[model samples]
Target: MHHSLFLMGAPGGGGNSSVLLIYLGLMFVVFYFFMIRPQSQKAKKQKAFMSNLQKGDKVVTIAGIHGTIYKINDDNATMQLEVSPGSYLKIEKSALSMEWTMAQQKAAEPTK
Candidate 1:
């Protein structure tokens, strides 16, 4: 009985519970700021990019296929990509890689 009491902490002091609550709150805040916020912001950007897509916009897919947006099917969330002259492929909007597409666009730009 005495050993259990020692393990459980002081019966009269409530400081430990308060401190634990504070620590958990701090951890939640840290996780939100460092992980959740950035991810949601990135998702918003990706959604906006996908929504703003139009025909003739060149893009790179997550699968590394480079093509131009030939047609957008809003109802099914798919698009037809022109991979080459007279060559086309159907793909999902979500398959587009924002990072690779940005990089490809940057490479296509003329450097000053």
Candidate 2:
């Protein structure tokens, strides 16, 4: 009976159980907005960029090989990259780094 009375009196000291629950809920909301949402958006944008890749696009591989897309074997999920005139390398389409390639392209552009 004493233990039961102590447990009942614990809620009277201004600490509410729902306060912890609300804090946990608020943390999830913050995590989803700051972490999950941006990561998902970046993935969607990367997928779109990869799908729209075509011949003659200059790209940088995740391994940092800079080259032009000479051919796209969509059925086989591979591409032929021409690192130099008449030289080529067949690789997976997923090996391309969207962020790195875009940065390289931006650097290559001449200022107006």
**Tens-digit lDDT track of model 2 for 11-92:** 5754456566677999999999999999999999998998899999999999999999999986748999999999999999
Instruction: Per model, state how many residue pairs clash.
Output: 0, 0
Q: Which ten residues in a row have the lowest lDDT in candidate 1?
A: 4-13
Clash list (residue pairs), candidate 2: none
TM-score for candidate 1, residues paired by index: 0.85
Q: Pairs clashing in candidate 1?
A: none
Query: Whole-model lDDT, candidate 2?
Result: 0.89
**lDDT at 63, model 2:** 98
* TM per candidate: 0.85, 0.85
Q: What's model 1's lDDT at 102?
A: 88
Candidate 1: tens digits of C-alpha lDDT, residues 60-83: 999999999999986759999999
